[model samples]
Target: MYDFANSGYTTVVITAVFSAYFVGGLAKGAHWATLAWTSALSLSYAIVMLSMPALGAWADLHAGKKRLLMLATIGCVVGTALLAWTPRLSGTEAVIAAMLFIVVSNTFYSYGESLIASFLPELATAQGMGKVSGWGWSFGYVGGMLALGISLGYVLWSQAQGLPASHFVPVCMLITAGIYAVAAAVTFSLLPERAQPRVDRGIGAWQQLRSTWQGARRYRDFVWLLACTVCYQGGVAVAITLAAIYAEQVIGFKPQETMVLIFVLNLAAAGGAFTFGYVQDRLGHRLALSITLVAWMAVCLIAASVTTKGGFWVAAAIAGLAMGSSQSAGRAMVGVLAPPLQMAEFFGLWSFATRLAAIIGPLAYGLVTWATHGNQRVAILATTVLFIAGLLLLLPIDMKRGRAAAIEKSPA
Candidate 1:
């Protein structure tokens, strides 16, 4: 169900549909709207991260974990429903509305993730944390692939019938939202309740926040892992967010062509998630992550130079492989390294790091696009450095060893 939401909500609509629509149609002439939307989205991520630990602590203290998840998921579903009306706005109204949707939707997404993490056990040892996370990602790709394919068929069928192009946009948004709402309901029904933290004699939110910060500093490698995550994750976000627009603007793909390309990418990503997650369970997260980053670097370089839709399609498939594998393996690594009872708090901070990149990656993309006079390829080329830098930072950290160390040092 989480995977369902991930694919339909995050990948299809946020990254592919509305993002492309906004850039290619809504404010085509005013690139600043794209810039503002990306910037605000990133900032919202930081805000969520900064506050998530406190919120997680509060949930623990209040013994209201499931209730919080319900609230966050509801907000995301409602906000996504509102996205159906996004195209109807114009000028400043469009920009503001898009930004609001992205921020609010993302906030709901991140908080819900923290809630889920609260349930993962503190120990599994050799199996690693990759399996579950990878399952979510793999199925997410499947869901996204299904949604994109259906939406694409609808658009192409409508076009063949000489129907208006604009009609498909609202329909896609509504479908994405409805499917997500259904998934949320399914998740609530099937997922088990998380074990609430035992009351800490007198621990308050501030104390938990301080302890989380201090505990984080005790593990020096955790900070470096976060740095790597920020860089690579930023690259991923920037690539996913802008790929549709880039294909439309630079690669000269029409709407139907773009949808097909995105569908292919999702298919490739689904394969990557399943394969790499299984492999990482045996091969180790560090190696798995490093391999994916290297692949991403190569993909970015080729994408930057590619001009034709064929070449872009090939590059998108390659990027999808990297995207799926990294997300699955990376979260597993985080789950391994995080403190035993502080999983939610740790994952919350990890979310912040990824979202932090969300801020930097998109703003950088927007800034480069603006500075280069709408040459999106240049912006893409610059993001290749993020991949290389991240791989380099990840080289020294042994994820297996890190997880062992985290486990050994955990309080009973």
Candidate 2:
């Protein structure tokens, strides 16, 4: 539910409709403001990486993880709804408000994600964690698709009636917030809270967080998984951040066409997520991830070469498939490698790895576009290298043994 909530907001407000509205209508109608907006967003992600582990440690000490997640979601939803009023800002006001939105929303998302590792035990056995992760991802994509469809419907209706394009902004923001509220409610109602830890004065909060970091470093497989996640996840991040923009620029897709492509891709993603989850349960995480990586490599290559709308949709479909399988299996893999009593702490660090890289990926692609006079094919090629590298690095990890290690640490 958290994943669904976040995706609805991310797809509609952050990545698709509202961003376009902000770039064109807000910030006094300056498109260059997008760079500042994106930079501020990156800073938001950096803050999440820096603070989530500390927050996790505090939560562990106080048994307030669920409470914190609820607070974060409230903040995110409020900020998203408040975007309707942000169109009036200019100069520093515009930049600051945008930053606040990014920070609040992403902070909530990162915290919520930390709690997901807790679900691993209830949702799947060690052997079935991949499928469980896939189900979550599939739901996320479905949520995004639903939100995007609403946005597209609004766009088409407004256009047919000769209404302004920016008219959809407030509607999108409200829908995003509304969906997030639902997700949060569902999460609070359905998910079990982690038990409070006994007071142990042996380690200070900071000391415990440091110990978690040290443990991550000391665990060779964990370190390897982090490295793979950082690289390949960056590719996924960049692809998503730019896919629609690229389609618009390269294939001349209208918003309606773009939404269709997104829908098809996400549907494929949903299928791949569930299918790969089952595959991982049977064949294992390493194999499922390996398949996803290879599939992503092909998509990246195809995206680089393809120019037609048909070709773009094909690439999107492939990307969708890779997105679901890889992310779901990866989360499951992380669950299998995490310390049971410290799942939230470990997930916090893991979030830092993947989410921090997400900040880098888009900026890198934007810089590449600027340097090459809007050339993006090269960027696609470079991302493919990251995916391939991740696959190669993951090849050596023994998934069966990793699952055993996690099960051994879990409370019996």
Candidate 3:
């Protein structure tokens, strides 16, 4: 249900509505608009990477993952709502304000996302982790659909009434923040806190970071997993961050058409996550993840090759299938291989790896687009190499060794 809360923030604000608004509406006259938006996102993700390890350590030390989760959620909700005020500003002021608010909102949102995943190990056995993770991820996409549906409905109605984007888009921001707040409220009310304060070690976040680094080689596969995650998830970040823009630029989609395209992605991704959960159990996590990577490569190839809107839609659906399944598999893999006492900290490292990927991926695309004079096709096509590198990295991991290492106690 926490997934239900947060997906709205990502779907409406990051994926569907707000990114394009930041580029086209807020920074309308700038040649560097796309780079500016992507740079803002990269900066925010860098903040998360720098902060999450310590935050995760604090959550574990005080048994405050839920408490921290609440704070992050509230921070994201407020910052997102604050974005509604950006439409009222003009020129560089509007652009600067929007970018600042995005940094605030996105940082909190990313923190909440990582903190929530720390609970997966407590909720399910190792054997059932994949299925449970998949189910949760699948439901998140449903939440994305619900949020996007209402936002899209409002947008269509406002368009019919001849309302401009400056009017309707602010309302969309309010709607996104509202759903995130309400859904997270439900999560806080119902979810039980299971992690007890660590009485054995009273170290600070920096000490925890030092200890984790010292013993990193002991959990060999986990380190390799992080490397793999960085490569593959970089590609996923590009897909998520740039999809709407790609559709509008390459396929001649209007803003409405882009929203509809993402709406379809939510539906398709929900199915993919649910279906792949069972497949992961039957086929093994590595195989399931490999299948998704292969699918992602196909998606890039197909997307790059397509000129017509119909072909693009097909590529988008394929992307949805690969996106949800790979993310679910990766999270489950982390749960399976993290030490029990250090779940939050290890997942924080997981978040760190993903956050790094988030920075690298969007920035790479942005730089390419800027260099190419707005040629996004070559930029997106280049992302395929990240996935290929990730797949090759996956070959060296031995899950049995990793699981054994995870179950043993960490050193004093």
Candidate 4:
């Protein structure tokens, strides 16, 4: 249920609706909106990357993961709710307000992901972690579909009533925020916190940082996983952040068409995530991730070459499949590799890698688009390179050694 609400925020606010509104409706042009959206993502990721390690370490040391998760969730909910007040592109002030809200909300959302993920190792055994993670992601996809469907219904109804879309966009934001808050509350109420062993309280942030740095040397395979994630997830972030805008500008998709496409993508992604969970457990994380990366590369190629709307839909389905599988495999790998006591700290690094990818991928695409006078096709093609690079890095990883190291290092 929590994943469902969180997925709603990502699909509706970040991926589909508000992103298009930011470029087409608010920023009033593709060029500025691209710059604004990427800039916001970059700034937010920068903050997350810098703070996550310390926060993760602190939460683990104090056994305060749940508390931190709650705090981050509240920040997200409040920031998302505030987006309801975004002015309808009347002027520069409105654009700035919208961007500010998105940045803050997105930061909170990222932090929540990291915090929640730290609990995964406690929730399931290594043999079953993939299935649990996959289920969560599947639920998220359903949430995404529900949120997008509601927003699409609103858009269709508003158009029928002769009302401009700008009037309904903010309402959609409010709905997303409400769903997230309510779902998160249910999760908080029902989920039990795992017990943590006592640790020395005198350990300072600097010591924690040094310990984490040293642990990286001890956990080389885990470090390799993080490196691979950086490359592939960078490409994934770019594809997700700009999919709607690309369809609208390049393929000439209307807002309604884009929503329907997103809805279908969510359904496909749910199946992919659910099915791949079994694959991850049977085939192992490295092999599963490699497969997904290949799929992502294929999707990028298809998206870049296809000129027809029908062709783009084919690419979207491939993307949805790859997206869910890749993310589920990555999280399961982290659960397998992280030392049980340091789960939060390792997941924090996971967030750092993901945030770094978020920063680099979007900024690269945004800059290329700006320089080429809004030519996004070339930018889209560049993402394939990231997937290829990630696959190369991942091929050398020793998943068995990584899991062994995690078990050896875990406190009894």
lDDT of each: 0.77, 0.74, 0.90, 0.88
Error of 1 at 356 (Å): 0.3
Q: RMSD per prediction, one decimal?
A: 2.1, 2.4, 1.5, 1.2
Task: Summarize candidate 4's per-residue lDDT along 273-372 as a digit string, tens digits.
Answer: 9999999999888888999999999998999899999999999999999899899899999999898878988999999999999998988999988888
User: Candidate 3 — worst ten consecutive residues by lDDT sum?
Assistant: 196-205
Per-model TM-score, in order, reads: 0.94, 0.92, 0.98, 0.98
Least well predicted 10-residue stretch by lDDT in candidate 1: 117-126
Better of 1 and 2 by lDDT: 1
The regions of model 1 sitting more than 4 angstroms off are 61-63, 122-126, 409-412
113-203 in candidate 2: lDDT tens per residue?
6665555655576767877788888888888888888877877888898876545667777877888888769888987775666456666
TM-score of 4: 0.98
Please name the candidate that would achieve the greatest lDDT relative to the true structure. Answer: 3
For model 4, the stretches where C-alpha displacement exceeds 4 angstroms are: 197-201
Ranking by TM-score: 3, 4, 1, 2
lDDT (tens digit, per residue) of candidate 3 on 1-412: 9898899888889888998888878998366987898888999999999989988888888888999999999999999999999999999999999999999999999999999999999898888898999999999999898889999999999999999999989999998899899999988998888878874675877888888899899999999999999999999999888888788767788899999999999888988998998899788888889999999999988988899999999999999999889999999999999998888899999999999999988899999999998888888899899899999999988887899999888553
